[model samples]
Target: MAQADVEVVEDMNVEGGPEAGEAVQVLRRVFGYEAFRGSQQEIIEHVIGGGDAVVLMPTGGGKSLCYQIPALVRGGVGVVVSPLIALMQDQVDALRALGVRAGFLNSTQDIEERRLVEAEFLAGELDLLYLAPERLRVEQTLSLLDRGKISLFAIDEAHCVAQWGHDFRPDYLALSMLHERWPEVPRIALTATATEATHTEITTRLRMAEARHFVASFDRPNIQYRIAAKNEPKRQLLELLREEHAGDAGIIYCLSRASVEKTAQFLVENGIAAVPYHAGLDPRTRAEHQARFLREDGLVVVATIAFGMGIDKPDVRFVAHLDLPKSVEGYYQETGRAGRDGQPSTAWLAYGLQDVVQQRKLIDGSEGDDAHRRRLSAHLDAMLALCETVECRRVRLLAYFGQESGACGNCDTCLAPPQTWDATVPAQKLLSTVVRLQRERGQKFGAGQIIDILLGKKTAKVIQFDHDALSVFGIGADLREAEWRGVVRQLLAQGLLAVEGDYGTLVLTEASGGVLRGDRQVPMRREPEKAARAARAKAKRAPVDLPEEALPVFEALRDWRGRTAKEQGVPAYVIFHDATLREIAVLRPASLDGLGGINGVGENKLAKYGQPILEVLAGRGTTDGGDAAGAGSGSDHAPPEPPDDIEEPPDDIDW
Candidate 1:
């Protein structure tokens, strides 16, 4: 068949059948699971029913079953090509324990062992044969799969196919060979993380452009989102570990191998069961360390970035980053490793100005593209904005990804919204510090030196340059060093500060110039600690805390949406969507004014869901109490605004 024809058939709508019914029966019998979720049945039908598809599901959302159950029904030795040896072995072993024939091929297998496995695969004795992607190009391997005509190709961690991805691999490049060699067979590329750009890249790169695309919804209600300033991070972490994550599986991320070791030791000293994992350790030691983390329950793994990518464990309750990740995608992909069981989880990070300089240095100092560097730095800046966002964490994150989210009560910012104050003067002072430091040292200083000089702290460098005597010295005496750090951080987040390593200095951006000139409205927000604490406590409540009147309606809406999605073989939100649901709840239009009563609902969506939405919100259970509030009074947790005289900007847009 032509590629376009294959595309048509791959996307052609097909409903459930007797075979699928039998598959469901067997699913309950062997796996002891009730039924399939999301598009698992359709995904399996596409793959096992002899077609192509790509599945995007969150971790612990049963991605494995999409391939596992289909492999059994396909009636051939299902050849699974994956990248990680540990993940491959875990899947293969689990299958074997279920009384099904399964095996794996990797460097771990000796020559004699390879011979035995190869012989079984050829003799049709194995139902599933898992091998590393790097090994798929070998002569003996491809020859056998070509001779036997292996079952569907399941590509786990399919996001790695995109060069723009965080975990891209070179060997994954050869995966297009599957399309060439197995043109008649189906292919399924699955990944947990792929934004719009990466999503498009996967289809183009994997040669799956002609295959079915299943994008599951991105909402993870169970995961509590958080971003905190780097205020006594060590002590803060200890308290969080003891309180919220007590006796739960978690991951604590640091930037370096030494930091991993030290932090792990510190946690151990404080009575948390933890161990370090990093590339610095010997191969044997790394293996043992990873094995222990997987085997033992609730054991925390403190490590650098190397410890990720291969982990498949579920029920990880928390993921904390002691330092900032390089990009928002890196942050999302890493933090996503937690709360995989669809249970309550936390995504927390402690960051500050130093994190900014380090990340910029790493990016500018790397061999990657200048454009990629710029984009990465911009993305990090956006994340820093999220850290300082007083609006809502979930809303900000969703906005960055080109989606809109209602206030998520589960995030720190939503529980106790940061109280805003006019900091136009402090901001002007800070911007002036940059101006003075740049001019004084012949434009040869960074934020750290400027901060020191501002706080009246004289050092050898300050004495050498006589910066202590500068007129700007002690001008910022009103604020402590920590508060000054907060100001600098907010400036960086706002694009008022830029650190280019080549300059080895802090250069004020146009935004800073405006702030200094008193021509912008500078809204300053303090660190949100109490909001985060309330979010932690409020999580004990159920998901989607709409008021009591809105429950049945939301539930009914979700059910109808779920059914529509399965029938179309698309994600739930894509059909009849979230915007449609929200308009229904908020406006309470008694009749189909065609969504005219709703603010966001336009003519197009109104034509599609105006009636359905009207039906749901009208028969309400409760209004969304909205996000977490002060538990006692449920008062607007927006922090009390600081004094008005703090600062005021000139009354016009400077830009």
Candidate 2:
């Protein structure tokens, strides 16, 4: 079915709400945007016209406006079912900043606060109401909804409804009841991450199979994707922080809580303002650290995967992973946190053979049946293939999600394509050795032992097994141990080798037979020279340039934003994102009206923060005094956007 255009429906009465044409007006006056991007205009029109939708837009792609605008144009309050309280709070705060009456019902709210929000909802004063799925499951909450007029139901993070999704929410399983009870209400489910299976599961579970599916491109071109072999990962991460992302707010994801603590400490010791966050930490400490990460500038949060699910920090300059992510979907979502202001950012990872082994063991040890294990294995295999692939990482990443994309020229492979060589001989030798070891000793050995035998090392185990007597013992002497290790890693990635048992013994898979019999040729990626790799990594750093004159004013605005956010006890971006500040710096708006003309500065924000912004722009250096004419409203100049990558959203609701 084709998407409907946002046309003026003549003679159509929306009962108590604004007509269809009023969406654009509300978009401009309230949220300060004059148009929509991609299918946002159509999606908003459909939902407002009482239709359902399943939107798979990327993060920072104006997914929120698809629901928010319709909610405003509709007759009643838009109830958004969110999985996390922090996410709800961020969305609500951003909506309120736009002068929209939005509130959230969650466990974090006290009785009085909840009551006030409920009263507002019943009075039909709220444009949007964000609710945690857990709260929505309550009888009283459902009863309250029955008592009020609802515009539409929006399910954010809709992928959570899939039991197999990385961020599955048990509470979301109860959300189907919303449709069962309110059969007349239109519903829209939205997520930034979902594969075909997850997508189907979402629509099936939510009973929105008939909902129009709007899937935008998953490519985040601004985020540079680089995967390097793990070599002293901590030192590499430190170098990444120092040389690439100095004084930038980012997240460094570790695989374990202990690693998170250690990495945070290491960063702090190295002069980075860093904090540790994980499920193991006390709630207060975690909350405090998360708050600081959000509230302060250039603070790094070293954490496990648990840290970044609902993070609304738009200017997270980078997302570095000290360990490999479990799947492409997980990696995509985790990295999607960065560069959300649309500025250039990086998604860097340190992957190695150990990651392969650890992930394999994790899958094997997981409590699941064979089918589940097989699915996990497939996911791991795909992840490994991506890490080891010489093709564009972005291309492969998107392909994994069922989207065919051309070479991005942004990922590590496209920037520095890896060299490949025919490794049929070496592969045959390695597989023959494994077969020899199994046949001669009726046992499989680890890669170390196999490489030892191949490199003609006379170790005790080799001697004990009398491996020196074998014909293949010295066959691989021409290749160095590291080269041989590469061969093994590649073979494992190719499914020609498998690591079994706690000892990580290498065993031949069925695919090994073709190579051993010379029926197939093996092509392997040659590890880039260290100097070349370093040079490529250096070249991949995104350039950030500001005019020399605008530098001081930018810093001044940042200082003012920091101070204001501190006083308000909110993230600096909550006051104004760095992109907005950059725009202000470049434009140097003269007055309140000039500031009001800015894309992100709505009437409420202009009135609340106009004078201070003007003072900063008038060379006041964050002080309270400046000539109002030099710093004040003069013209309705529309400030140009920050950069090509730093896209400005037309509206609010930081989804």
**How many clashes in each structure?**
12, 5
> What is the model-wide C-alpha lDDT for candidate 2?
0.76
For candidate 2, lDDT tens digit of each residue in 4-93? 011101001212223437777776577544455667778888999999999997766667778888899999999988766655665666
Error of 2 at 579 (Å): 2.1
**Please, what is the TM-score per model?**
0.77, 0.89
Report lDDT (Cα) of residue 488, candidate 1.
Answer: 75
lDDT of 1 by residue, 14-84 (tens): 24444557666545444433355567777877787788888876544556677777777887777777767
RMSD of each candidate relative to the true structure: 14.9, 6.8
Q: Which candidate is the best by lDDT?
A: 2
Cα error of candidate 1 at position 256, Å: 1.1
Which residue window of length 10 is worst by lDDT in model 2?
1-10
